[model samples]
Target chain A: MSTLQGAGVHGAASWRITRILSLRWIVWGAAAIFFLNLLGVIAVVIANSFATHWFGSWLPAGWTLKYYAQSWQNYQLSGILVVTLQVAFAAVIVSLLIGTPAAYALARRNFPGKRLMMLAFLLPIMVPPITYGIPLATLLYKLHLGGTLTGVVIANLVPPVPFVILVMTPFIEQIDPRIEAAARMCGAKTWQVFLRVLAPLLVPGLLAAALLVLIQTVALFELTFLVSGPGSQTLVVALYYAVFASGIRPAQAISAMAVIYMLTTLVVLVVTLRYVRPTQMVGTVR
Target chain B: MTLSETPVASEAIAGPERRSLRHRLADRGVDRLLLLSLPASLFVLVFFIYPSIYGVVLSFRPLKPVGAFGNYTHFFGDPFLRGSIVNTFRIALPAAIFNVLAAIPLAVVMRGAVKGQRIINTILVIPISLGTVLVADGLLNYLGPNGWFNRVLMAAGLIGHPLQLLHNQWGVMLSLVITGFPFAFLLTLSYISGIDPKMESAAATLGAGPWRQFWHVTLPLLVPGLAITFCLSFVLAFSVFPSATMLGNPNGDSHVLAVAAANTAFQQYDFPMASTISVIAAAIELLVIGAVLGLRSRFYAGTTTGKG
Candidate 1:
């Protein structure tokens, strides 16, 4: 009878523990609800883009693919797509060119005013684009570079270079310095030490940083929007115009444009995740 | 004998001196690598730094032909322009607080060897990739007057009419949360993951319950990081431009600081006023960040990670 009473007490304690732990369940449930809502948001766009008629109903009345064609022709999406690709690629290549070597120096060297230099680099990333973009855009227009692809590319480059430095600094720091020492000790020149020993190890980091920057540039709207002209508008900017333009076109066409933009970013994002964790991009706060 | 002795001393000193100079240069690898930082530095100096300084200078020259500080006086004098700052804070603060608060629990759970952590992270980051434009577009349709959200509510007999979810403050707030939450979650995860789990384990060994362990041990360690996450989130939300214009009624309730700046520059052709507004927005953003960081130092100011 005493042992049976002990078992009952143990059951009561276990039940209390579970009740306390149900807090975790609440957290997960909230997250799940949020995730479902996001999916629904995206789903509605996709469905409406293809729908023949999507009034207040559980589903669209019918489905079609002609909206994509209408959007492409109406918006001159082909030219915009080309410009988007060119700007994204150009920005990525230039940023990596300037950023990688700086990241290497930052990781390896202990120079005077290094902390100040770092803060300088961090400033551009911390300050929002719209904050500085206005003056920059004004200056670009004054210099005759605004309303051109070059202006957009230059404006977009401001953030990504610093971003590459921040992301790659830690990656370069993770590398053992002794490899460079060993290479030098083997009678390798400084350039040789960098090229033969460091470059191979740095490739993965370079790839990851490049891809992340690429994804950012593709999605980057403010800088591009501020400087881009009618002829030079990127996909996102063009989509914005289409959505807000006089209501001659159907909603389906605008949704179609949004879907295309989504696909472009999603493709790059999927590729980027393979190279780097999403947290590492923004979490290089320190 | 004196001349020979002087020559011998000179040779001895010159040989080692030249060799050591080269040795020092080589040892530091200062030949060309550090100079590589110059190009990137110059690029930022010319593009980022110069433009900001130019903006500040330009703000002194208003188009309305007044004093150097005329734009500032005008901005403060006008209720509509000044109220944009208040409107921005209204949207940014709550969204940022909610993001950080919600992210902490999720980060704590994910810090462990949790299942589907990667999947959850990927799903959360989708809004970031979608960018503000698409997110605004999606939210408009999904939460519109006849959207599925209201449909479900009506089907359940919860409300008689579709709730006004768009063209107001709520629309912008929702968009900011959706886009900004991933950033908060990711930053918090990195920070919480950085904290040494050994501290929590030790607390548990000493008979501390999970809640007690979190409050006493983990919470103190996370204070600095959470502060940073909140600041970053606030900055992003405070600079709301496209979403504020697209989702919210930009002409009235959602007339954020960015909209004011954009209109001053593009619409009114008042470049100086636009620059002035942007500078003000940036200053406000910095003030909030400074305040939070000041608060953070009082909470916990030490090594926040195992790596440290």
Candidate 2:
């Protein structure tokens, strides 16, 4: 009996050890993949920027900052960055200005066809970008707005406005309505109540929404590619043309620019996540 | 008698007039709010609603303005275009299956009490925010014939020549997997975490092993999440454009509905035909989403808990 008990104890101990090892293995494996994917892209871009020719080798044969130096000397990199920043900033501001009021209206008031309006706003997100890109571009061209930065910004607004509204509505809903009512009772006007009472409470949500919209606008490809002209091409669209239509050298330069854009976006997203949780924005969707 | 009657009549008239003025002011306040929504409302109507309706109408019209129903007829009659529709379903369905299948094990492994979960989560989510262009670019550099994979294979003496991965359907598939898997995995992980651990432990105590417990208890509970994840990932992969264009040969066998529509509208300037294809794509997407919603309602018919 004692021998049988001893065998059982040994088996249990082995099982426990295996379980622990497996769990540890899984954790480390996930961590390794995460680092490889995230850091790997950065490493490739950095390596390509320096190497004259690194094909067929695990590591580059040589390294220099010549590509970065060349990109700056030509002014292509700075020009694209300026345009990207301008378009993304304008798009985010417009989306926020338009979306906040709609979000407030949806959250605060009981209006007719509220559900229908909500669906209308979300429709842009549901349909594919390709479906709208052509028609929107055609329509913009007809209006003489096509091939302009404003045109690309307008096209981008469709997604960002709805996204902001979706994110901000919950934030607005969490603010105590009674505070607004009390403000009214104290003789504050409707606008005053919104400005003084509610806006402060929604500061985090607003920042989060703005950052999200900005990131999305900067990363957006299809609509911008379809609508943007030579003068208005965003960095992403520019990079795309450089890679596909142009030669490898320009593609490398563009990739270097893309790395900068991606890194900036990552920084913004991390900051946003730290300050404003997605759950706070999208958690109450139900 | 006349003077007294005049004074009373004037007072009565002023009282009614004052009440009507207040009503008008209240009405004006409501009207102003409605007016404030006008700009946004008009924007949506012109940009979103009109384009969508135009797409639907264009689908019915011929590419050459022959007549209504011509373009759709052409789409249906041409075996090549018709084959694209089938190809779309083939790609989207398998991608959804593969993504969901991969998500389960990845989520299961990640859910174990482990350190660095946050870092892993961040890594998984990074691809999602990286957008399709970057993902495609990375895959191109890594998986292309002259890229890392082939180089490694050649060095290892596994193959005499480089393998062709880019400019093929599999290239698009790999791009989709890399981009799509993170979304499915995250959704499944969040869902699985919400499930009470006691149920699994109870199954374990009842002599069921981990695999069996997962297959019976955990999998059943995960159905709602699986359905939603499948639909979401399928919708995303189905409407793929940048990846399809950059990674695959759109003019060749890889032309799906979105690519075909883009070609018609942009390349040919045939808006009607393009619109028609988009409308059809939208309808198919709606039907799939609707079916998933129906399944969700059926599955949760008697349950009180909400499934994300």
Q: Which ranges of candidate 1 are over 4 A from the true structure? A: A1-12, B1-31, B301-308
Give the range of the ten consecutive residues with the poorest summed lDDT in model 1 chain B: B299-308
Docking class of 1: medium
Q: State how far residue B22 of model 1 sits from its true place (Å).
A: 9.4
Residue A7 in model 2: lDDT: 65
Error of 2 at A115 (Å): 1.5
What candidate 2 gets wrong by more than 4 Å, as runs, is: A1-42, A72-75, A248-251, A278-286, B1-38, B109-114, B153-161, B193-218, B302-308
Candidate 2 has an lDDT of 0.74
Question: For each candidate, what is chain B's TM-score?
Answer: 0.89, 0.80
Q: Candidate 2 — number of clashing residue pairs?
A: 1
Q: lDDT per residue, candidate 1, A1-286, as tens digits?
A: 2333446767656665775568788888988888978998899999999999988788999999999999999988999999999999999999999998889889888766788889889999999999999999998999999999999999989999999999889989999999889999999998898799989998998898898889889889899989999988889888877777827799999999999999999999899899778777677665
Against the native complex, each candidate's DockQ, computed on alpha carbons, is 0.66, 0.38
Displacement of residue A249 (Cα, Å) in model 2 is 4.0
TM-score of each predicted structure versus truth: 0.93, 0.85
